[model samples]
Target: METMMLGVYKIPEITINSGIDWLGICGIVLTALIVVLGTWTTIKNFKNTTLSQEAVAEATSNRQFVHIKAENVAKNRQEWINGLRSEISNFISACFDVRSVYLNQSRPTGLVPELFEDFVTVENLERELKSKLIAAQGEARRCLSLIELYINPEEQASIDLVKTAQEIFHRAGDTSFNLTWECDDLVKIAQGILKCEWERVKQMV
Candidate 1:
């Protein structure tokens, strides 16, 4: 018995379970996937919001540009109208001066120096009117076409009168040039027409 008791020892056996809980692992994987999906959705929404803001900004800029362009067009149109009015007024005044000189056989007291100097003879008067008529016609052709749309077509007869008066002046060796009555009539008719046009233009403005 003493010999048998000399070498007695006990050792416990350890076991390891290699099997995994696949369900729990699957749940963890699903949670991670959900987090990734949420992050992607947030990023997409931010990009869409940025694009929408840029579109709105572009639209606003376009509207402003159109508004400014319209304003400039209006301003230019008004300036043209004003210039037409001024030219017409000068032409009318010249007609009146011619009429006054023809009727009184003397310069009017209030006549501008240049007008008085220009109408001293029928030839001078004709030259003055020719220059003025050229300016008036140019303005009418270039600028007043739009304004004429609203005016009476009969107003154009004034231009015809001017042309007729000019022809009379150029009729070589024609003695009617010195006839006060003829010159008076031509100037008067032209004056009336210009006044009518000026009034119409004023109303429009």
Candidate 2:
């Protein structure tokens, strides 16, 4: 009976040892699972951080492109306006020369036989004035075309310039009428051109 009791006690001790080994195995598995989950979470966070930084960098590059385009357009616009101003200045100078030459040859100069030569000089001056007026009209029309191309806002200024140029050409074409008759007409034409140029310069900005 004592031998039977000792064998039964040995079986219980074996059972306890088996249970401790199983517990240790379960603990090691749980620790491995925790390590795997932590590594996956860290990888996901790093990927998300990289993508966000890339998106910000792309947006910044796009903004720079837009700014550069705006600046280039503005620069080209100013250059166009300056070119028109230079053309107008040349036209005004030419008109002034025509007017001065016309004014100087107003009255006849010389006596007897020389009177015929003086008359011829006057006639030649008149012809030169006519040619100048025609040239001025052509240039003024070109100016008007440029203004339209540049999308100028000052319509009244353009109209005034065109009107003065037309008037000068018409009077010159008619031999009976003359630029000397309207001394201020050339100046008026110059003023009108200047006004139109000013409007164009303002629009460039």
Q: Go through the candidates in order and give each one's C-alpha lDDT.
A: 0.55, 0.60
For every candidate, C-alpha RMSD to the true structure in Å: 10.8, 7.4
Q: Which stretches in model 2 have alpha-carbon errors above 4 Å? A: 1-22, 104-145, 151-205
lDDT of 2 by residue, 1-205 (tens): 4554433545434343434677888999999999999999999999999999999999999988877776677677567656655655554444445455455446454434458776787677668767765665566456545534543445766666556555654444344556554436645654665565556545544
lDDT of 1 by residue, 1-205 (tens): 3555555486777999989999999999999999999999999999999999999999999998887776666666556546545544443444334443344433344445466464465556556656655554444343234333423446556555555444433431233445345545655665666566456545443
Off by over 4 Å in 1: 1-11, 101-205
TM-score of model 1 vs. true structure: 0.48
